[model samples]
Target: MPMPHILGADHVVVTVRDLDASAAAWAKLGFTVSPRGTHSPHLGTGNYTIMFQDDYLELLGVLTPTDQNKPTQDFLAAREGIERTAFTTDSAAGGAAELKKRGLEPLGPVHFGRPVDLPGGGTGEAKFNVFRWPLLENPGGMRIFACEHLSRHTVWIPELMVHANGAKAIARIEILTADPKAAAEHMSRLIDEPAIADGAVWKVPSGGRRADFVFLDAAAFAARYPDAVRAGATTSGAAALVLVTDDLAKAKAIPGAVTTGSAVSIPASAANGVVVSFVAR
Candidate 1:
């Protein structure tokens, strides 16, 4: 049987308590964040986005105290950091079916659309179909979902592509877990790709040409970037994102950027509670 296509990282969701504050924090680090937008009334959430060439980063927060907002609220209550890693697919329904075949029951091709502010002073609809599984746990955790874009205009704004930090793409997503082997197996099943064991870490190819997912147990995670853990990131879940920038020196000049070897890390306090590492490629 042919393997299912997993199109790397579509975007990572950072659940924050305040979308405005979080957007400000990211902007301070040189990212061009989109204006805030709300989800459908049923979803009860609002977000600001940082658009990249192919993928993006979403800063999400609860908008209203409705049932739909419960998940965002809960995620924030638990830890306000990287909460999800969404993969892109050509078809979300097909992705859900393939996941079922692998013994993971995916929820839906949930259809939804949001109003986007157009550059020319009007609004447009950006639609999506998302498939998710409800049973996955996140102790050193991350949510895996597949997204199908119905309208490309909602994202990929040329104006939002320019960042002062020279960040162009995501290099890697690091998740810290209690058990690397189990996490690797779970990710392998999700993306239909074999996990490559790397000493104390497991590498899962995101099918994202420029990115990969790296899972490390607590000890290894701390040993590799102790400062991240020390900054109050949850010891067992989606940890830090490594972004590729063309000018390391310019990126290093961003406030709160600390250089560790060839990479510069922006601590959680300055990032609205997420750790972002910048690597000049």
Candidate 2:
């Protein structure tokens, strides 16, 4: 039997408290969104709009009062800091076979996708022949799911960036936590990578042609970039995705962080930092 191939990082999702606020804020970070958008009425999946790219950032939060007609623990209120790593794949059957053969456990092979009409007058849908970490039955810990696009789009960001012929950038996504070793080990096990073997620190490579994943402790992350901890982000289970930029003043032009004192220590070289509004911290 042939082995199933593991794809690179898909998208990082940060659950937020307010949809309108976060959507407006993230737009400044170079994300032009899609026309189709809605907050989940059932599972909180409806309360978000996604920006397409090689590695897109998902701004997720709670549904508004109108959407709250039905009660659900999942999206009724946004958990303070829980960060979920969402992934997608082309071959769910192939991946499932590979994992099962290896005696690995997965949460699900649930299918959730939508259809979009073509420009000409026909309709096509995105299929999710994928598996999730914590299955739909038990959507534990920040909600994880796999997406399988049926029809490919011309403007795929993550694919373009990953398969770029030139520029080997984004060496790794350094995730900070209090337990560097545990976080590293868990993610490593989930994604089939090596354990970090230290206090909350691990490195998972995106195979030969992909960037690696590096998990670090809060203290270590702060040490590497002193501007982080001082940013006044106080969420429970999320991360501060400090994207690198060239224009600091342009970002500083934004009005929120300055008024709320959300970002205090702007390391001269840290570009213009924005408090990840979706994460609440």
Candidate 3:
């Protein structure tokens, strides 16, 4: 059988210039980020740095000063900004195998494990069994990486480094891309999901749980959504968003929150655009 469309967004990776600062700020907001780690010789190049979560946010940057030096300056050159969205799928075996049949190459079923300490001082560890697979044919364009969380500890949101709120819901993602229509058709056919478009916006939900991406013209969308703000999104090419909250008053009380507008939002639109709305835990 064909592989599943998405198991959920699994985790989002952002390339940042300052790991400590970003991790600290997000932690203050409740996300649990792991200590910084250098790239493994196994991952090729051995020049990457990362932070983790079962369902986590990867803060990638150069590993050391030498890696940050000259010819390699681009890697650390102030993060003029780079962001990529990742989709976690149901079957790594089936997905990778199937993608290979379609002429795509997947990296591995490699695993990543790390120790984690909680805000209350309790400590534990987690493991990640992952495989990097191909989605779009373009080498550096878009891809799918399978991830499994092996944290026997805390109640963290497996896919995100963000705290587990036990929120029973996930929002859809709409990607604004160069060829929304084609992307929609390809993804719909590949994942067996119904795809539609209103111009160049391709929309699809992470096969399992919940998460979606719609690719469209960035400028046009900001205008259409009107009250959107891209606060804590991946620098990745794909657009990330959070919608207006239903209770601005309530959301404000939450720490680390930065309100954008006046009107409140429904739970449905929590991650709809580029913002943070009061969502149910």
Candidate 4:
């Protein structure tokens, strides 16, 4: 049997304590963020999304601490940062079965929807079927999942894709872990891309999604992203984002950008505790 298709990253979730504040911060960083959207009352969460062409970034926060929001709330309580990285899938059910065949039992093909405020002040719905496979279940770290976009029209708005900072695409996700080999192996299975050894670091090449994953050990991670480590992300999880920019000068001019060699790193302090690096194209 053929392996189920695993599309590249759909969106990354930055779990924050306050949705409005986080959205404002992202706007300051030059992203065109969407208006706040609330989940169904039962989920007790709200979010602001920065929509890109193929992928996006989500600022998710608990609205009311119910059973559904407890895990996310606890994550924020410990540390506020990139909480989960979600891959895109055409079929959540098939993905779950493929995962099971590969020796990882997925949690759900969980069905959920949120109300989206359309551009013209109309209301629409964005539905999803999610399958979560926990490689690391601890708080203040990254969780891996797959999201099947039921209504693509409702989520990907063309107007929201334009950013002032020349950010064209999400290039890579930097994950810091104690064991680079193990984390890279797990990410390989999760994203269905074989890991390539790059000396001490391991990288998953940007498949069709045009985004990759980089795995680094704690010491190397701290050396590269000391603020991310200081922000309570000492354990295994998604640490930072590498955004591809069209103009290096434009990206460098963004407030709080720290030029480190050729790349400009926006420390976690300004980015809801997630380090954002801008690489000139």
CA RMSD, predictions in order: 1.9, 7.7, 6.6, 2.7
Q: Kindly provide the TM-score of model 4 when superposed on the true structure, using C-alpha atoms.
A: 0.90
- For residue 77, model 1's alpha carbon misses the true position, in angstroms, by 1.6
Candidate 3, residue 259: lDDT: 42
Ranking according to TM-score, highest score first: 1, 4, 3, 2
Clashes of each: 4, 21, 34, 0
* Total backbone collisions, model 2: 21
lDDT of 4 by residue, 1-281 (tens): 22465677778899998789889989999889988888878778889998877898999999888986677877777788888878888999998998888777788888889988888778999999988885453222467788899999999988888898878788998888777777777666655578889878888753575688888877777777656324634356788898988888877888867787778888778887778888987
Query: What are the lDDT figures for the candidates, one per model?
Result: 0.80, 0.44, 0.46, 0.80
Where does candidate 2 stray beyond 4 Å? 1-3, 36-44, 47-53, 62-82, 115-125, 135-145, 154-172, 195-201, 208-211, 227-238, 242-281
Steric clash pairs (candidate 1): 8-206, 140-236, 140-237, 141-237
| Per-residue lDDT of candidate 2, residues 5-59 (tens digit) | 4566566555555556656544543345433344333333533334333455555
Evaluation by lDDT, superior candidate among 2 and 4:
4
User: If both were scored by TM-score, which would come out higher, candidate 1 or candidate 2?
Assistant: 1
Candidate 2 minimal-lDDT segment of 10 residues:
271-280
Once fitted onto the true fold, the runs of candidate 4 whose alpha carbons sit more than 4 angstroms away are 1-3, 135-141, 222-236
Put down candidate 3 lDDT per residue, 15-129, tens digits, no spaces: 4555566556445434345555544433321211222332344555444545222322343353322244556655556666766776767766666565455556666555556
Q: If scored against the real structure, what TM-score would every candidate get? A: 0.93, 0.62, 0.64, 0.90
Residue 243 of model 1 has an lDDT of: 92
**What does the lDDT come to for candidate 3?**
0.46
